[model samples]
Target chain A: MKKAKGSVDEFTQAYMEYYSQVFSSILTKVGNAEDARDLCQEVFLIFFDKFEKIENKRAWLYGTLRNVVYRHYAKKDPGVDIDEVFNDVGLTFTNGFRDTRIIISEALEQIECGEDERTMLDLIATHNFTYGNAAGVLGLTRRQVEYKYGQLVKRILEYLNSKGIKDIAELL
Target chain B: MNTSVEQFHQLLGRYKLSRPVSPGDQEYIINSRKQDLKDLLRKKGKYSLILWIVIAIYAGIRKFGIHITMVQSKIIAGMTAVAVVSGSSTGVYQGTKYVIKAISKPPAKVEEKIDEPDSGMTIPDRRTTEEKTKEEKKKSADIKNQDLDATPLSDVPSL
Candidate 1:
């Protein structure tokens, strides 16, 4: 019993460390604070249930959160369109520098990228994850993540250049 | 910005900073985590109860002088297997029925037409081009009439 309690405490400690990061990630995806909170709770509960079997806790939490968010949207709308969600990714950005941000966001949206690539960008840009860390969370090799991110950046830059915005400083 | 890449990264960093989680939210999540842990433990307790009941039943049977024959043991195993198979089949049947019903149900506020030449195979046209043109023409006529009415008498020619 004492050993069980100790293990529970250890799990709780680890859960607390990533709770905010996980919650924010869900919040960004779902675009609702209340739903994000509920999903975050569900993710941790699942983590607790599978704690013994999970080798990589952070990665598992993230993957589970993704599943939870997908399930939530799927349940809310039976025919949820993923492309519609992707097109509205600009709404997920912060309010500061609204014009430039929207432009950059629209440019990113125009780029034909897979969901995995977009998720990798989110992990690196928003969650501040290192390439290796993002790769673990996304269940990808580090090299794959690096290549995808590089391609995403190149596309965004090309998009900006096509828009006659040669000086990146002008937009900033 | 020296480069677009640097500008992009800087903007993302600023966006990340702008979206910091509040202390209240953190606290709420912690409290919810504790509740979840308690609920998980309760579920574990339920499962442990079943295990304990099985153990107790086995112990009681062992203590009794009643020795089970091989035929009886085989019969019991056969019955258990049959029960499991029947239960799983029933579950699958019910699950498939529910999915089919859900898929067949029509969405709200949309009238389903039953006059198709092919009943089950015909895909309904969501919005016909003829209907769209008609609606557009009606809207344009309404706007033109409204504009004519809004024109002042002074602006009209004395004819």
Candidate 2:
């Protein structure tokens, strides 16, 4: 029950505050609940230990989380580099999605699939997870993910096509 | 293979991730924190055990031999400490002064004082040494005469 170097609640409160985002990120990255738990714990343990001296708490946690996730992936598969897809996508459809985004969101929300496929879509389409990473998350093979994810995309496209006049290029 | 498909995939993920996490995920966050606190307490307990062990070892050392002293020795040691603290300052100062003097010895050969003839010096009293002695004796005699003259007339033998 002894407090850490600083106030006792600091680590606990920070744990409560940032754990979800960090856990979600780690889960998204490592694609395993158990590994994400362990890795997120590792990040927070470091955070707890250095809590007193750290300045930018969120930044410190995120930075440490990144390294921890990277190390986890590296240990799992030496060739896997998640950093390549870590950056946000810059596409023509993003900025002016004001009208199209509502349509897209509605269309995507209407489409339903199995929990596995839903989790897969959540990982790949929502969480910025790559096909291989999504496969790892869903416990599916990479080839299966590519095929299924492509089918899902085609379904979404067809749905969009059905809801609209042809020429998908016009939305662009 | 299509650029649009890839962009949509990424874009959808971005929007989904931006939304608030589901309530189910809160359970994970809370459980992990409980684990953190549990592990932290274990670590603190470990450190405290080590600290207590250190304290116990130090207590044992004191109780066994090293710092154990007879009352007489303790009193004597206390008196010695008091003496050193209260009485040593002047001694230290004197010792330091002498040590400084000893360290910086004066240049080996002291310059001898040369004596000169008194002829060059003017004697303010203007009397020769012999005359000075004679004048001193005469002054003492005059003092005696004055003393004799100071006797009261009543003290003279009744005529």
Candidate 3:
């Protein structure tokens, strides 16, 4: 049998060298640590799946992370200002844990009646895991985390509209 | 832009307040990555070496099975050497041909820039001219009004 050209070890090494960079790339876009970490893992899983087809695995990892983050943002209100949360939370959280916690909390409050939603949101927000990180702890997709967060926001908006609340500040 | 700069600083402050990941966290991540790469390279090299060794062993087994004499073996070895040398020389010749061809070829030509036609004047100049004309018209209108006022009712034409 022909021996494989690249091994699991090689991929792992590449992942290590580039994992932080991938996380950094995702965080820069997603603006949350747990989400960035979750995306980081997803990037590796993608690397493992497409290992044979990829030429430069490191670049592939970064590109995949970037795409996932963009997809997350796109699913949300494209007009939603990421910079607002990022700036408000402050970049001081290099891991972006606090920011992610705060954003998730804000998003969760917007969402309506699902006991599971509150439980999951509490696990992530109060405990301070990123949507991505929470997904890992909860066994979900990074996309799922983003979607849930989005749903929460939508529910909150609906609730507010029903209550005649005017702005995001009202939720606060 | 100024506000973004201020906002960036504020974000940076919040980022610092979060729980620290610690030095060990970073090291663990980095070390695991290094080990993975080293293992991959090592595995690849070992596989390549084994392949070459297996081929050599197989060739030896076939050659001895043929019951070749010393003289025939020597001749075969000499011919193999000649073939290898000739093949290399042929490769060198082809490489040299490409090099020479590349060296002799002229670089691609770049087009010279041609000046474009100017529409009589630019926007700012046109605006200034328009303003100046309006000013001149105003001044003339003012002089006509002054004349009308200065000339008495005697100078005015009868109905």
Index of the highest-TM-score prediction: 2
Off by over 4 Å in 2: A1-5, A85-172, B1-25, B44-159
C-alpha lDDT values of all predictions:
0.61, 0.60, 0.50
**Candidate 1 true-interface contact recovery:** 0.09
Cα lDDT of model 2 by residue, A34-134, tens digit: 88788887887777667888987767887898888778777868887565524332333456455567667666666766645655555556544555544
As for model 2, its CA RMSD to the true structure in angstroms is 22.4
List-wise, what DockQ does each model earn? 0.04, 0.04, 0.02
B73-105: candidate 3 lDDT, tens digit per residue: 345666766899999999999999999999999
Instruction: Write one digit per residue (lDDT tens) for candidate 3, span A80-153.
Output: 55454334433334453664435533444555545336534443333334555444323356667657755654
List ranges where model 1 is wrong by over 4 Å: A1-6, A81-172, B1-9, B13-159
lDDT of 1 by residue, A100-137 (tens): 66666667556777655655565565555666655543
TM-score of chain A of 1: 0.49
Global Cα lDDT for candidate 3: 0.50
lDDT tens digits by residue: candidate 1, B44-145:
552244333332333233224233332343455567668999999999999999999999998869678778476568776789899999999999999999
Q: Score chain B of candidate 2 by TM-score.
A: 0.19
How do all models score by TM-score? Answer: 0.34, 0.36, 0.26
How high is the lDDT of residue B55 in model 2?
A: 28
Cα displacement (angstroms), candidate 2, residue A13, comes to: 1.9
